[model samples]
Target: MKAGSWSRLAAACLWLATAGCSARRSEPISKAELLTDKPSERGRVVFMEHCNRCHPGGEAGLGPALNHKPLPNFVKRYMVRRGIGSMPAFPQQLINDSDLKDLMSYLTALKRHERGADQTALEEINSRR
Candidate 1:
């Protein structure tokens, strides 16, 4: 991954470490906050507002959820810029480069946190024996 991606990924890791500890993880995240919050929070919020209707939490909906697994930065950039099949392209006008970076970062961090959660759960289960 590129350095920018790594940094975003790091930020996301930090977010998970801190944010996951709260009860808010169970609370729903709103789309309006995505645009109004600090810069770092924009990506997921932008996605929820624009992309979530079609793809929720990276699961398959009308379209595919980005979080199903890890995807390359370039691939995502291309897909959004160029569009594929039934999906439509998102030009720079609609989503600036910076926002795209945030989106990728959000997706990567989301997956890592999920893996971490799964591991913690598994460890807890195994420890019971």
Candidate 2:
């Protein structure tokens, strides 16, 4: 290959690398971390503003109640980023990767906590035997 061609290829490679380096990878958020006030609150606000249009608190509206079993990480992220059915995609500007992770964690934590509460109640009743 000619020197000029090689130089052009190198420049292209460098540009691609620099661009990739600046792009942020989505990090997995911990359930405990999201349950906290900061990220959780941000997520909650984002949900209410964007999702509440379709999904009501408990009762179903345009969409099903999201209070069900905590969705798998992929599903949650997909729903937020890609949107399902009639849902609209939440852009990264509105909800970044961290925000999405935190929201998913918070929602899942809520579901798990409810399940634990129910189990405790069941155990108490069984102990009466």
- Name the best candidate (by TM-score): 1
Candidate 1 local Cα displacement, residue 3, angstroms? 26
Global lDDT of each model? 0.58, 0.54
State the lDDT of candidate 2 residue by residue for 16-128, as single tens digits: 55331211111221112224466666666766677767764322477655554334567567657766456677889988888787777556544444444444555666999
Clashes of 2: 0
Candidate 1 positional error at 108, Å: 1.2
lDDT of 1 by residue, 1-129 (tens): 975566456544543554333111111321112122344367788777667787766555796445533456776787778676577888989889999888777666554445444455566679998
Q: Looking at model 2, report the run of 10 residues with the lowest lDDT sum.
A: 22-31
Cα miss at 51, model 2 (Å)?
A: 1.3
Clashes of 1: 4
Clashing pairs in 2: none
